[model samples]
Target: MLVLPAVVAALSIIFAVLTVGINFNLIHSIFIRKSLNKSKSLTLFYLRFVIDGFLGLQNAIMSTFILLKFLEVEYDEPVEFLFWISWTSMNCFNVRGILVIVISLDRTLAVFMPISYHNFRRRIRNFYLAIIPLSWPIVNNIVLWGVCQFRVNIPPGCVIFTCQMNQCYISYALSFEVVSHAIIALTSLILAVKLFIWNHCTQKGPKSRDLERANYLALIDTLIIIIFDIVPAGFTVKFPALSAQFGSLILVCKMSGYALESWLVRRALKRTNDIVSVSYANNSSMIKSTGQASSNHRHHRHINNHAWQ
Candidate 1:
């Protein structure tokens, strides 16, 4: 079971990076070309691409730090870069997690209450784009300030910080981190589920089915990320000795879940397409210009997004 988790994590990390790398290219193209008729869906997706890449890079940093220890070659006095990357990613992921839940809720709303969704329509997703990156600095300051104040010391090449055992209460940085992440994850999960059930009651049959699937997938993704990442990350920060091994296992689980999430999203969206296509076909409304629907750019986006992030 243990080895399986490690292997799954390594594979997931590779798969996640490969998928996100391709998506990074696509969003960059879309962002650069800047001509595609932008919809809220496209905007939210591109925004998520940015957030995922940021968090993915942070995962890389953390994985590298741990791997350095496993190889027994860490010869540094203080692994300071990790202190920042770890917490920054923590904050980034939580904030982004909230945003993902919000977007999924929006999609659910659009399906169930297309009329009512207009009220929640956002003019500037730009505000979110700016706010998420800005959150990293907040995480950074909090971590740095705590370290300076607490003076967590380890004399012999600290793989993880070794603070005074009974002084765990003094080390409140991690306590703060854990509480913040837990709150965000719990809140997002509750809202996502509530809106999804509301959707079940309100949507047309087929649209409801597709949204239900997406809603379910969204909740699953959120739960996995929380259980596998946030909870372990929290414990590891607070009690390194007790949590390190378990934390490593959790990291791997998180990476694998991320890879799986990509597939889930593609399938959910394809289901959405299926429901849309069936609705059109049943109406016998033959398109005058199938050409635009099958245009090269659209085809390219569809093909490329198969490795969706």
Candidate 2:
């Protein structure tokens, strides 16, 4: 049973690496880079990109730690310190959740208000947006550090679990998760409603099609985040003794979301390329038709000149 967690942790590490790779690729892509030049929404997405990257790295390291501890890998470090580090990382998962909420809100504004979204300055938004996501992690770490220091008892060899800890830690953490999940769920619902409304109100032209596609992608991503947060965290709260197992389950869902997002990005990029190709072909055909029309007009003029002569 212990080995099951270790195996899941290994798979988590692999997917976390994939998540990091895809996020970095997105950061470097032409669209993102161009957005850096053109859009305030880029700042929001850059924050999301950073948050996702941090989550991936955090998951990888913590999962590795979990695996090593499960295998009873020898380490000179004190058990208390190991426990502190692992649980602190686990608590910081709230920061990731809150960031998703920020992302959902930011995207909501962008999608619903094109005029305001485009007019917004990146500098102003970036400062505030950066503070929002960054602050939660700092506050979460502090609270987590305080709780673990004051509440937890560390067994000599096992860093992952100890016999006794105050209920405050679980209660506080669970409340945070539940509240964050509710907000995300609400945001997802709002986005879905707006998406449907937008589709119905708009004509089925290229512009509307593009907007629908973007909205649907954002809607799906938000839903995935909600699912990953709610299910495993709910189980963890319900079965605190099996937190390690539930944590592993959460990591699995996180990795699955990462994989799904990567696929979405690839699909979006492919669609963009296809649209551009079709546009280019249309332009080329139009130009060819214009040129042939001109050539025929010239040929007719030449025939009239010969007949007049």
Residue-wise C-alpha lDDT for candidate 2, range 50-136, written one tens digit per residue: 556666776777667767866778776465666655665554466567766776776677667877775773335567766776677
Task: Give the alpha-carbon lDDT of every model.
Answer: 0.56, 0.66
Tell me the lDDT of model 1 at 307. Answer: 64
RMSD of each: 12.0, 4.6
For model 2, the local distance difference test gives: 0.66
User: Best TM-score goes to which candidate?
Assistant: 2
For candidate 1, the 10 contiguous residues with the lowest summed lDDT are 157-166
Q: Which candidate gets the maximum lDDT versus the true structure?
A: 2
Mind giving the per-residue lDDT tens digits that candidate 1 earns over 109-187? Answer: 5545666564655554546644654465565455555545444343453333222211443354456545655655665
